[model samples]
Target: MLPGRTWTRLLVCLTCGGVACSDDSQGGHARAHYQETDHPVAGTLEPRSTWRWCYVHRRTV
Candidate 1:
């Protein structure tokens, strides 16, 4: 495999921290993306997100 590609995958996983396991409408599979957030005043580093994936009416959203 390409080293760059592998490194990117690793970064994505690490950046997202832990992947939560659960049954969902997306065929039990889901992915996470980094989100830009700011609250209570901006800072050098962003805080952890409170977003998550779940099934809605048998569909992933």
Candidate 2:
């Protein structure tokens, strides 16, 4: 064994916070990254999101 833990164990600790788990990506990092943020603006939406450009580049013709 390493002074602390084996590399695999260390990675597991960093990823799962130590022992027992469901999703490997089920830890503080996951929770912090994928938190439920539910609060849509009442009634105001652009015809389309500028973010669309991220998924599919747009070209003005």
Candidate 3:
């Protein structure tokens, strides 16, 4: 990967013969993958004198 290079080709390079995304941008992917829905952040451990969690995962039980 090149410097300052995002996961553009990385997405399309996905093997397994699947419909990979060739989007070289950083929006839909973030919303689809890194968004706080599927792989949410862990909001359980206490922050270091910050009172804030890093990966704050808010889900309904």
Top TM-score model: 1
User: How much lDDT does candidate 2 score?
Assistant: 0.23
Candidate whose lDDT is highest:
3
RMSD of 3: 11.3
Tens digits of lDDT, candidate 3, 1-61: 3467455422311112122222345443423443434443221122342221222343321
Better of 1 and 2 by TM-score: 1
- Model 1: residues >4 Å from true position, as ranges? 6-46, 55-61
Tell how far residue 40 is off in model 1, in angstroms. 31
- Candidate 3 structure, TM-score to reference: 0.19
Which pairs of residues clash in candidate 2, taking residues 3 or more apart in a chain or in different chains? none
- TM-score of each predicted structure versus truth: 0.19, 0.15, 0.19
**Cα lDDT tens digits for candidate 2, 1-61:** 3254222111212222332221222342222222332211111123443311110122211
Which of the two candidates, 1 or 3, achieves a greater lDDT against the reference? 3
- Candidate 1, residues 1-61, lDDT tens digits: the string is 3333222111112333433222222322123222231111111122464333322233322
Worst 10 residues of 3 by lDDT: 12-21
lDDT of each: 0.25, 0.23, 0.31
- Model 3 clashes, total count: 2
RMSD, model 2, all Cα superposed? 16.3
